[model samples]
Target chain A: MKLPSLRIYAFAYLAFLYAPILLLPIFAFNDGTIIAFPLKGFTLDWFSQMFANDTLGRAVRNSMIIAGSTAVLATAFGIFAARAGTRFSFPGKGPIMGLIMLPLVLPEIMIGGSLLLVLLAIGIELSILTVILGHVLIATPYTIAILNTAFASLDRSLEEAAYDLGEGKLSTFRLITLPLVLPGIISSMLIAFTISLDEFIIAFFLAGNEPTLPTYIFSQLRFPKQIPMIMALGTCLVLLSIILLTIAEYVRRRGLKKTGAKDTGGFL
Target chain B: MRRSTASWGFWKTLRATSRSELPKKAPRAEKWRRAMHLASFQFPLPVLSSAMLRKRAAPQETRMAQGSPLSRLKHSEAANGLALISPTALYAILLLAAPLLTILAYSFFKDGYLTVIHEVTFENYKAVWTDPIFRAILLRSLIVSGLVTLVTVALAFPIAYFLSFHVRPDRKSLWLFLITIPFWTSYLIRVFLWKVILGYNGVINSGLKSIGLIGEGQLIEDPLQMLNTVGAIAATLAHAYAPFAILPIFVALEKIDRSLLEAGQDLGESRVMTFLRVTLPLAMPGVVAAVLIVFIPTIGDYVTPELIGGGKLPMVANMIQAQLLPLDNKPMGSAIAVSAMAVVALISLAFVFANRRYLRGPK
Candidate 1:
């Protein structure tokens, strides 16, 4: 109450941030093509149309393949890197870790362009595989970030205790360490999947003739008649993203709790 | 007053009597009582409170303590670290590092009419540096991104402060959670939503028209042209990057030792003075981090400017995209991308240095 204006300002800020995104579902259900308002009668024609499109379905399938593969690869890579980073320090550790995290901030356009040139020059054709390659590059950093917290929070004594009890290193990892960090792995996979699923530029550049969801939406945006269907698709995507992120955030928090780690502000 | 002191004496005597029978439980009971007091406490500690430092360093200390037996652990750990990290290291080198190095190499190569000439030269870099359009777009991109960072961080600070200081401990996570829900939505769609809202016949225009701010006939003729402008881009960028700004700042604020603020106040400073002299200074690292996080990505963003800026106000990323694909100028694109990366790298370094300075207290 002492700074009532600050409270109001925060609310307004949240509203300004969320209001535009709230429009997607509104227009998706509106029985109109033009994005202008006068609240047309409600209809699900756009959603039905979106479902009936073959190209849209193929794009969705392509995106799913790319996202799934990227998630597994990135999370797997993340587990190793995070474990190493937390457990040990070596020469050039700082620089190596910095280089790995660079893609998180580096422009996707640069990575996409660079990758496209290299792949083409090397006589490799572009496809969903190339997109997955690009996605793993971007998603790996995020996975590492999440998994780093998980690995760091792990009580090292737990591992040492297992070792003290005569368990081999690999068996100790499997029996104790892996089970302890399972939540972290699941969280990392979910985050990587969400990131890869919604990724645009890399998929745009590397998909070549293949149509992913973003590229399809971008292409369809040029046609005025397809706007409603795109809106419908956007609505569904927004819902899916909310659900996925909720689960990811939940798992992340749960992992932190299980490991007795302090929350340092994750995706949620 | 006499009765209260007498009761306190009685309580102390009672505790002393019970201690003999429950020696092990005594320390834990006292610890629980102290914890409850700290939890309900509203004041803050002085700058660099050792208790806060100890609390923060608890995990690190434990990690180091577990890292004894140097000769044995080192050999095994070193080998295990190398083995464990190799897959990711190899992946980065093959996909990310190789591509980036290729781009650097390509930046020096010549682009012939049909085939890319293998001959290396400084032609592309020279073109990027000397071209007035590239310079203008680069400057514009930096300015736009700077504005976005400033606005986003400024708006996020108070929200983060409110969350850290005003919100209840139990509800803070929920508020933070709600704040990030918008982030889960596709960023491209969020940018596109801004386009819709700011379009000629879009939400803003229609709302103004319905409110009679514009004549009915003028709706089509004289709508506010907000899209494709720098202001629009900045607004959209700020909205898109709010969570990125808010979360870091909130984390920084949350980590502040509350007794520090109380110490300042106890030293005869007013509330505002205490905040200015204590709270803001401690939160600077987070603010710097938030700025860097928002600024770096926005400066290199092609999508927002492409969709919302409508190609009229192309950022450096947009120019790079044009050269790489439609313009058939990979060398030039690589040069621009590399230049942008260098600039971003320098800025990040400066931010990292600033964060250290903040942590070390202006020394």
Candidate 2:
């Protein structure tokens, strides 16, 4: 734990974590098809190739569609569940909340497998729709947990004032509650979208013929040569996830500061 | 002088002997009842905490409220709360609960080649035990997961310790950001990268050879032998679960009271002994949490093993996936799913039990 040793250990750990990531962009820009060292001359040909593939483009489009839908649906549900747990008094409330959060601890395989069985029983064939439904189930709990604090911190009187003005619940929520907690809502949506986008095992089980990006990436890696492209895709995903997570952290911190709950919640 | 000194020494002797009382043992049923009670108690704490929070927070409530006091918002607040969470509730019912229900029903059925016949039977469970491969892979999955848990926790502890205790303010986030590297990319790509690194004529052997570390022709090929070995699988899995291990340990470290460490030093323990006696014991919760996080998921991991194992090994996950996807044997697959879930549920229960007793708080 000496300062120098700690520094070395910290940097080495970082190198181990990030060296492969560093390799991705390097190879992505390499003009040569090979992805070995003794650096190939730099070029963006592979990125250009990425644009030419219609199927890849379509997959991206489909992924965007699914990610967006999952985010909105999951966030909407999260806000409700979070509110119920935070503000309401009802019987069986704890069990219900535990059930909502149950998927968090349960294996994704179990959830996915069980959902597959249920979907088949209902004659719902796997598709992007099915994938979206599954994503929503897993993502909702996280959304709810994150939004719970935001909902908890909201000055309830804002909604109360709207109600006293004779506004209905829906309108009050739309106008007062929604606007004040918008930062949390946005954070929940971003995280949910990223979870849906990068999610694989669930998407693999649910996305029958219509593959999402992760599934597409899975299939592409079956051949050794396609790995470089996968690395390129991974680099893009890594960059995207970092941006998404950073924005999520920023918005969440801002929301916490806004509500004056910044120092607590103990590691989030 | 003699009388006073004798009295003081006698009192000290009495105190030392009195301190060693035999610990009381609760009856088995008593312990069980208390556990059930404690878990039940925890069930409402979150709800109650938020409510009691309302009272303590009254001052801020008035400042933030539009017109009336903050507590007045409760009448309309509950309604708005329900509205916000409806989508999450609806999706959970349709996708998660419904699918799990179907599996429960299917677990009772029989499959014939292409069709699933609906008749309640435990034959699938019986068949699950009879299958040798199922037994082997289940055990293998457990072993692999145990290795992954052990390795990742061991590796993550030092880095987490560095971040939590050793680092300056400016560097904490950077180290955490670095630790998050494993999580940022497609998991499949990382698996494939290890495939190259561990493959015959891959980097490890070839690089070793150029440096005269190993002779030529000693390059590690025969991927059928090496790729899917437990070692390879665990290495890849360790990387995946590292972030999971880091998060909880980091949290636990941050929660460590600095005064306790200073107390240990004030007691004249050396640095290493202070860490062993003081810091390690307190971080036990994080270690247990790390195991739970890493072990549970690693056991269910089919993708990493499947991609990297090259058909040599099949974890329970791969088996479950195959049964449902390609083989189209839904009943058996659902059975596999149930079996796997049964194991996870049991471990989780034990984890809760341990958390209550050893870590949450003093009795």
Candidate 3:
């Protein structure tokens, strides 16, 4: 009890942060229409409703496609740039890398709004493709950030030795470098995928008539009756996101260990 | 001497003629001639164009001394570097740079009735600058976002400090991980959950009523109009950004060398004194980073205030959304977006400049 104030404050702080979100699953399962304390007996109706909705299914499908495409696209681009960045000395390296990571700090609304204008001006129809484009732009930075460590920590001597032994450059890269950084690649893909999946504003502005999951959830918010179902969906999404992030963090950490690199913090 | 000079001239003519005919000759004949020339000279020709490398290189002889294999590797490396990075560079330019510049360009144009005027003008900027409501919303958004940053960082510091200093090192990541799980959830859902919790008949009110804080069946009047207020929005925003604030500050805190704190304590400073004198100063970079990360996005946040504040307290983002979506004033929205980015850039620059000492860390 000696100066226990800090401990109590920390507990209260975490509660304040998490308690509201914890209510998401609670009220989703609650049988009552009104979201409140008196939990009407639990039921699976909201889950059923969420699964039965055709629009929700379509939105889910659209989101999955966008997220998957973004993950692959961003990670592929990330690998090349990260390899170039780590393995070679080049001009304008600082500015080039800075621009690549700029989206991490730039306001998403600006990105979404500007891209929306540009897309319209160019007469490219807004679809899940445009959403994927935007997601890839944002997700690329995260992928590169993850892959930089992967590429940087790699022992250069291994590649040099392969080359010295008369291995072709492409074959050497394929045989040695790819397998070593596979964990980083996996981590980057998962992180990029998660980022794209949870993303809203870019998808909202650019998806046009197509509904992604976040946009669908936002649209459904106007109708009070759909609240419970949205909650159920939220519950499932939160669970899935946790699992994905945990695996991603694990892979990233494992990569660091494999390369004997110091942990410089990660998603976790 | 005359015969030697004549022989040298003959050999030079032979070499020149052979070089000229080498391209037309078969590969085997060219290789045989090159091998004969090398054997006669007892040395190999430089792989790099000696004239080009020497003319460009200030340390010409040094590069020549490093020889062909390394130079060939370097040449191919430069090419490989370009080849590797070209795709991402192209993608960023086309997707990110072009659109951002377009937004900047659009801010200077006029919006027609239903279409954008191709004529470039500063009318949009002028209108956005002069409009009082727009100015007020912009200022209010900055203030609200600033407050949220302050509140979030303040709240996060204690938890981060506790986690960094008190928790077992082995379990620290677990604690950090648990705290950040909420962050991975959809931001819209998180905001909506706040709405449900703070609504007039929402969780808090219902919980209070059930405990008899309000009279039975007094549902007609709102017991607490918690929703649709700046404070509520700030609270929700702070909650949403808590993990962001915590993680950075935790990283900064954990980086503080334990020896420094021990040294401070050994010198008769209390734990609190050591933190204020040593820890706080060292962790400023993280705090600033946390501030910038939370502030910039929250200022442009349309979802939180729209959902939680119920349009009563519109942020700059709401106005931008209004102009773009319903009003169809793309130029005005573009101007607002530009102005918002400018304001954030200015504030961040100022913050960084003001805290240059702390942010730069220990010399």
**Candidates' lDDT values, in order?**
0.80, 0.71, 0.80
lDDT: which candidate is best?
A: 3
lDDT tens digits by residue: candidate 1, A86-176: 7653434445666677786677887899999999999899999999999999998888877877876788779889999999989999998
lDDT of 1 by residue, B62-181 (tens): 443454656445445345566778898888888888999999998888998756888889988888999999989989998999899999999899999999998777677778878987
lDDT ranking from best candidate downward: 3, 1, 2
Question: Can you tell me which runs of candidate 2 are displaced by over 4 Å?
Answer: A1-4, A31-40, A152-177, A263-268, B1-87, B168-175, B209-226, B267-274, B351-356
DockQ for each numbered candidate: 0.35, 0.29, 0.39
| Candidate 3 Cα misplacement greater than 4 A, ranges | A1-11, B1-82, B216-222
Q: For model 3, how does the per-residue alpha-carbon lDDT over B267-328 read when each residue is reduced to its tens digit?
A: 99998899899999998878887888788888988898899999888998888888877888
TM-score of chain A of 1: 0.97
Please give, for residues B93-145, the per-residue lDDT of candidate 2 as tens digits.
Answer: 66667677788788789998778998999999999989989999899898998
Clashing pairs in 2: A77-B87, A77-B88, A79-B84, A79-B85, A80-B84, A80-B85, A81-B85, A118-B99, B200-B220
Q: Compared with the true structure, what per-residue lDDT tens digits does model 3 show for residues A221-263?
A: 9898888899899999988887898998798788878888776
Worst 10 residues of 2 chain B by lDDT: B1-10
Interface RMSD, in order shown:
11.1, 11.7, 13.2
The C-alpha TM-scores of every prediction are 0.86, 0.81, 0.85
